[model samples]
Target chain A: METKKIKLPLTKEDVLGLNVGDMVLITGQLVTGRDRVHKFLFNERPRKEEIPFNLDGAIIYHCGPIIRKSDEGWRLIASGPTTSMRVEMYEHWVIGEYGIRGIMGKGGMGKHTLGALKKNGCAYLHTISGAAVYLAERVRKVIDGWKIDDFGIAEAMWLFNVEDFPAIVTMDAHGKSLHDDIEKTSYRELLRLIGL
Target chain B: MLKLRDGIIELYRKVATSLPPDVEDALKSAYIIEENGSNAKQALSTVLENILLARETSRPICQDTGVPVFYVKVPIGLSQVELKDTIIESTRIATEKIPLRGNAVDIITDKNTGDNTGKGFPVIYFEETHDSTLTIDLMLKGSGCENTGQIYKLPVEELGAERNLEGVRRCVLDAIHKAQGRGCPPYTLGVGIGASKDQVTRLAKDQLIRKLTDTNGAPVLADLEKRLLNEINQLGIGPLGFGGKTTAIGVKVGVNHRHPASYFVDISVCCWANRRGRLIW
Candidate 1:
């Protein structure tokens, strides 16, 4: 129930102090990425010169926003978190390779991701899954984007300036996961109901 | 016909932004039953607040606006081609006007059409009927729930599932168990039993268009729906799978005759948002 406001480029101490079920309101520079971005970063391994931004201690968001081109520039209409488990295959590689400190998305990741988070001193944040309009209000600005043509709107990487971007620490750096625990208890309950 | 096109856009807007009344009611009741100060309650409150914001702001209720699926019932003498073209045009217009997330992508080229319309986009299921009036039902189904949908060919030896209702019960519960938090519970399950493998899945999805508040016409199916709903909620997979009393708000089951050799059970899961609307022309 603790509400902590954390800045990006998080340190080991910053993530280690958080525990599963703790609520956080993150502020600072964040980059949005999803299925394609994960593949691009880990699988494709773009040339160093093609890398658009530095990833050292960066926070990666699992989001593919609904953005429109306005008279001035890109306008974010609804940007909610996408399911994170889709990127579980490449999360470990991306976290270790990029020196990422935090991952924000919905539904928790799998065992590999949890292990990677523990090893890399990173934490996984869970946002309300379909709160598109509510989450969009927290975005202060859209800084820039990269690989737009290559990945499409849902998969492109967009840098955003978000303030008080709320999420819950569902998987902490200590190797604990709220999702895994819930699944275990719920499964037991299911079996009990079915008399299995 | 132009009016129908405009009505389709409005329907899309309504489906994208406003949570349906039946769904909102279910959510409200679930919130009331959730323990005070529990994580499940907190999650449900967040979802309720999000729905309010979406309605006020006229923005998508979820980031993945999902593929626009239309179920159309046409009267005799109506041109199916004309109706489909109107739907496609309206979908593109809605993608820009309601500004729905450009969800339809070209799988081969890895490109987004950007307007939510592409080859075979805005999936339409047509039914020609004797009634003179035309009715269209639309549902915006997000991928999170879509991914959790399952189809199993019975008898599933592992689960001891057969072709009877007992087997269908086992499969439905298994699907709910597998979904856990991923499908964004509480879910509205649409179960289709006894159709061919390919058609069974479509039958399951078609069941999702039924109003959440409507009761099944068949007595046996209605009883099964009641039992499934009660058992699923008892799993404590509450709001967002955090653990509580309400995991699923509704379960709609549709059954059809099957071939002698094969029995298929298909489940279509829809998250709490349950964005759906209807139009009559």
Candidate 2:
């Protein structure tokens, strides 16, 4: 149970240092994106003015958070990770184009995303799925957002100042994946159980 | 006395904010038995803690509060139309007040309604019961787990699965196998077996409303449920599929009379959250 305290915007060295099953408590800025943002980032390849936040060395959280507007500002009600595989198709391109350094999500990505993570110096951090309220407490503030109107609240990219946000590096820059290992073992067990 | 709309809103809030007692109990037992410092143990610990925090803060347990599904039972002559209208209205109120995620999207336009309501949204099923009391069961099923659900027409040669219970068992194991770590297990599976695809799909989802502690009346189904539960947990696809002892905490099977020509099975894969509640008025 080696836990690393990580501060973003990460360097390539920071990503290379993590390994599968190593838990990390990350601080500093995290920008949330999901299906819509991935497609836009990959397809449009927007220049500086379109995207409000910096993607260079930035950690992207694969989330469609439940956010509400408050008198002071916006309140993140529940900030759980969405399934990571859905955005796997666009993630590789997003990572390469935007210089993304870290991916925080649940249910780790597929082979392409893993390969991109290895080639591009990134790590896939797996948070506890559906542990929304608990994880939301770690978000220090709602820094800013873009595409809230066009993409909708859930799909929009919002910058968050999070402190000690907990996650485990399931898919590391070394091309190791805990998900693949678990799936293979479980598939073997399934075959054994079904007598196939 | 609370109005029906108030009751429905409260039901939505309850399910969104907290899981039922049986689910929490199952999670607790699974947590107790897992190896300390294991990834599976740590994940379950976070889940348990999250559930408590949501309860304390009255916040949604998961951001994907899911597509709201309602199972409504009304007395004879009670207007289902009126009840559905109230349900739709209550859904809007719950979306804003409870602050549930606006999940319903326009299939054609690719736009979120931003209120969790749209054409055929907040799926509702109505049954006219013989009794006077009206009851509604609400489930906030997360999309991640729902996508893991599998529907199969039996007698498939690939797995050597036939139409009988033995075949059903094979199909179930395959479904769980394919699901792997994607849906955030330890899962509570609801299996529906019937003659038609639509019928079985509904039956499967209906079975999910059954409590983790409920006992199936049919001895054969109960035995199959017990065996399937044991077998799935044996797959070592523990909490978040990090690998440990518990892949699934409960397996529920609801069988219906099938036609001579067709045998269909649907598996409703529910994540550990398994958020659900009932309102009677």
Which residue ranges in model 2 land beyond 4 Å of their true spot? none
Taking chain B only, the TM-score of every model is 0.98, 0.98
DockQ of 2: 0.87
Instruction: Give the per-residue Cα lDDT of candidate 1 at A76.
Output: 92
Each prediction's Cα lDDT score? 0.89, 0.92
Q: How close is candidate 2 to the true structure, as a TM-score?
A: 0.98
Model 1: residues with Cα > 4 Å off, grouped in runs? A47-49
Model 2: lDDT of residue B135 = 87
Q: Using lDDT as the measure, which candidate wins? A: 2
Which candidate ranks first by DockQ, i.e. highest?
Answer: 2
Model 1 alpha-carbon miss at residue B150, Å:
0.6
